[model samples]
Target chain A: MRDFRVLLWLRWRQFSDGLVYWMRVLGYNPKSSGFFEKLYPLYLLIISSFWVFAMWGFGHDNAVNIGSNIHPTSLADLLKAIPPAVLILQVFVIIVALRSTPLKLSFADMSYIAGSPIARSVPVLLGFLRQVIFRLVIIAGFFSLFALVLTRPLAQNIDLSASVRAMLACIPLVVLTWALGWLLGILRLVYPGVSRWNYLWVLPLLILLAATYLPAPFLWPGQALVLLIYGIAPWWVYPFLALLAIGLVVAFVWFGNRINMILAVDESILHARVAALGLLAFRQPNLLLRIRLQSAAAGRKPFLSLPKVYGFQTLATRAALSYLRHPFMLIFSAVWGGVMAQAAVWIISNELPVQLWIGWLLVVGIAPPVGLLHVFRIDVEERFLRQFLLVDGLQLLMADVILPLIATIAGAMVVWLAQGFEPEITSIGALFIPILAILLALCGAVALTNKRVLQTRILATGITFGIIMVVGVNFSPIIAFVAAVLSIMTLGGMVSQNA
Target chain B: MADKSQEDGPLLKVADVSFKYGSLNALSNITLEASPGQLIALVGRNGAGKSTLLKCIAGWTQATSGEVHILGQSIKQNERFVREHVVLVPDTPPFYDELTAFEHLQFNAQVHGWQDWEDEAEELLRKYGLHANRNAFPFAFSRGMRYKLALCMALLIEPKILLLDEPLGPLDPVSADDLWEELNGHRNDGMTILLSSHQLPQEAHPDRYVIMEQGEIIAQGSPDGLRKSLHIEGPLSLDALLRSAIKSRKAVKADA
Candidate 1:
């Protein structure tokens, strides 16, 4: 008990010190800050509160509108989809937990706490709480609003009862899912021998696949939660879920008592490196990606080699070979394209408000596929490696991005074809995918080559897309294509000059 | 080799070069020259602009003013052409995370349009004691091994002027000696070498020493010439040279 208290105090001190450092970075030193500087955080809080309330108000109004206009059959279909979506969400959580061993310790914790005679359950419990707290709050809040929308169709007045019930149901589901994930991860960490089992992370997918053949029991948890949200489940359901969650937590803690400190420290090294980066990790995700890739490839042999080729072809083959070795990057590129295309179709087909278009544009601009300029960024950034490549900047960029661009286009085309649009529209949309992919790649390469900040890059991408949309809507697709091609040429020249 | 008539001229020259990081002068009016078959030791304290000078000479960084010339041709006007003749291996060299050690050399050779480079690449790995790890990624290598591999890559190109920044810092003593011997071989072949170091191997000797302090060259000469000019009483070493040069500069400042 004494050790636990001390560990908790250490954790608190670390958190406070980090907060102080971040505040100082923002010109608010805790030691000698002026009154105005001290009030900066309060002012930020008030502004953020206003923003959150405004977003909630807008979302609630949209939900009400949707509830009233949506067909009764469609509501039933949505309710049906809810259970499967929840199950899939839990599966994703499990897969992610397995992929990175849920028990993470920062370097400080590994050095100061891991080697000490403290009970292992303390850090395990603390880590679980830290990981789940923010996620629990955010997920419950979103589900509460969703419950309001579902209840609006049946109730004449705004009732907080169903939303409260939904929030309550969501709390247990999140805890229970995370607890299960933690249990599996703790088991893996407790016995070092289990880690040698190749593709252990794939076990979750196998379980999910097996669940498809036994849906009734596999989906009961999700269905029970939905039933609770509707205020129709028996009184025992929520309590059962709460107890199950507690039970899993206890099991994981019990398993944690036997964790191998060496393996745990080894697994946490990657996390520690990224956590040490602080805000830079968020600002420069490529650094995070590089760290993750290095961790993944640490002890593994590469699957492919550069072909015996010459000149630009050598660069192209090397990029292709890298993609082959790490096919997950290509998979992510395809998924990003598919998801964005589906969202774009949803907006257009439903004739939704224009603000959603802005939202889509923001996502497209800010979160261009991670693989879009992955290799190209390294090429331009590493002066040592860059000197070896005799090619110009534009050629290098194009060579590195060709495979990912093709994958993205293929993904978008598949989504478009699945949507079953008219022949002419399908042809036009298909034609637009390659152009948009190329334009996106060029914008990223240009910003990176010019050493622009991320915000500036996002704004540039947004403005370019806006111009294209305006021109295409007001004029002709052909003219828009010409303008886009011209912009590509200009951006290409900039990249080349900078390169 | 590209210009036979220019063989008589200095191989590498930095004429009145200056560099600034924002308002801080990193290198000010740093002028130096290296003739063929010369090995120059760039001795300086930390942050004394040795690395910065090497970068400027390599054309990896453009100086604020003045010129870096290779074989009498301005690097600014002929950067790509000049780069083919000059290479700078930074202190902490970076390599591709996806590439094996040997693949780095292969990529370098292929990009330069070289044919039948396998034997040379293998020899370099063996010479550097990296042959066992040729199939391993450089990210997995120790710091000293990574530096050695980087040196091998630079040597594979056989540039006319080679600039090494703190090359001895990451090397073991024996490896350092081996490096000096190999550098001696290159120097014999007319490859001008400029390396920044606080200390040299015990058995190794450079043709000249260019000592710098605070971004400015304070003293530069052969061992005996520097000893005679500075009126030093003891056998010359980098530490003594630096101290005497700093004292003389301070004295001059006080007099002014």
Candidate 2:
């Protein structure tokens, strides 16, 4: 208990220091601060409140529209989708937990706590609670908004009480899932030999696959929650979920008592290194990605070998081999493409609401696929390595991105074709997929060739959008394609010249 | 006269080069010349513009004024050509995370259009005590090992002028001696080398020492010449030389 308190105090100091650093970066000086400087925290709070209020408005309107008019039949589909979606989220949590336990320790924690005579479970329990609570806040907030959508007070005449009941039910589900995840992850730490089980993370996915065949018990929790949300569930369902949550928490604490601090430290080295970067991690995401990649590939043999080739082909082959070794990057590219395509299908099918279009644009701009320029960024940034390669910037860019682009296109096409648009629209959408993917890649590459990557990326995105909106509206699709091609050449020329 | 000078002139030349970071003058009128087969030690305290000057000469950075010439060609104008002939191995060099130690050398050799480079790569790795870790990623290696790998990569290129910034900082004493010996061998082969260091191995000797302070050259000459001209009263060492240099500069400033 004392150890836990000490650790908490340490965490508090670190958090305060981080807050002070951010305040200073925002031009606040505590010593010479005026009323405005003191009010900065309040300003941040008000901004956050506004964002939440906006999300609430958007969510309420969309929920009412879907329930009352737009895709009224899909409301049943949405209800059915919620359970599987929750199950998928749980499965994802468990899979990550199995691979790398949720326990994250800073360098200070490792130095001060790990080697101490304090009970091993103190740090473990504290870490578990910290993660669980952090995750709970995000999960609860998300499900609360979702609960409002499911209630549909304006459309279904469902009272606010049902929404409260639904939100309450989701809390237990999230807690229980994370508790189970922590229990399983802590057992691996308790028995260090389990950490040696190659590809143990795959077990959760395998169970998910088996659940497709036998969905009775696997999806029972989600189904119960859905019933609870509709206010039709048996009274005992709530008690059952609460009991399960309690049991998982007890199991996690029991296993956590036996945790090997040595193994925990070993597991946490990568996290500690990244956490050490602090704000720098947010500023240079590629640095974070590189650290994670190096950690993932630390002791593993690469699955693919670079072919014996010469010239630009060698670079392309090396890039392809790199992607093959880290197959998740390719999977993520495909997933990104599919999700963006699905969103586009939704917007278009609904007659292209301006709000939806704006949302989609924001998502694409803020979160371009991290892998699109992963290899190219390294190629350009590492001057030591860049000096040896003889290719021009455009050639290097194309070589590095060819495989990921193909995967993205493949994924987008599958989603676009599966949506069953009109034949003409499908063909036209197919044409747009490659162009958009190429443009996104070009935007990222152009940003990477500059020192200010974030600013350049946002600027490039704006210019690209402006050009497409102007040229795409005034001209035919073919002419738009020509304009996009010209834009690509120009951007490619800039990258080459700068590179 | 121009043709004759081009044929036999210094292989590396920095004529009145200066650099600035915004308003801070990092390198001011830093003139240096290095002929083939000569090794020069750029001795300085931290932030004495040693690394900055090396960067300028290697075209990794553009000088604010004047020119860095290699083989009678301007580095700024003929950067690509200059790059092919010059390699700068920084203190903490970065490597591809996806590449192993040996692969780094192999990639460098292949990209440079070398044929049958495996033996040479293996020999370099063995020489650097990294043969056992050849299959390991460079990121996982210790700082000393990473520096050694960077050195191996630079040596494999066989550049006409090699610039090493604080090369001994990440090396052990034995490894440092081995590095000096290896550098001596390269210098004997007519590969002009300029290395920056605050301290050098006691037994190590360079053909010339260029001492700097506050981004300006305070004194430069052969080690013996510097020792004599600086009026050092004790055993000549980097500390002694640096102290004397600063004292002389202060005396000259006071006199003016």
Best by DockQ: 1
Question: Local error of candidate 2 at B85, Å?
Answer: 0.9
How well is each residue in A105-131 modelled by candidate 1, as lDDT tens digits? 898888888899999888998889988
For candidate 1, give the lDDT of residue A158. 72
List fnat per candidate, in order. 0.44, 0.41
TM per candidate comes to 0.92, 0.91
Candidate 1 CAPRI category: medium
Which ten residues in a row are the worst by lDDT in model 2 chain B?
A: B1-10
Local accuracy of candidate 1 as per-residue lDDT tens digits, B1-256 = 5486267677888899999999999999999999988999998889999999998998788899999888988988776776688888988999988888998998888888888888999999999999999989899889999999999999998988888999999999888988999999999999999999988876767899998999999989888888887778876777888888788888889999
Clashes of 2: 0
Tens digits of lDDT, candidate 2, B1-256: 4246558878888999999999999999999899888989998888999999998998878899999888888877676777688899999999988877887887788777777778988988998899999988898899999999999999998998899999999999888988988898998998999999888888878889899998999999998899898999877788898889989999999999
User: Would you list the clashing residue pairs of candidate 1?
Assistant: none
Instruction: Evaluate model 1: give its TM-score.
Output: 0.92
Q: Write the per-residue lDDT of candidate 2 for residues A219-258, one digit (tens) a residue.
A: 8888998788778898898999999998998888877878
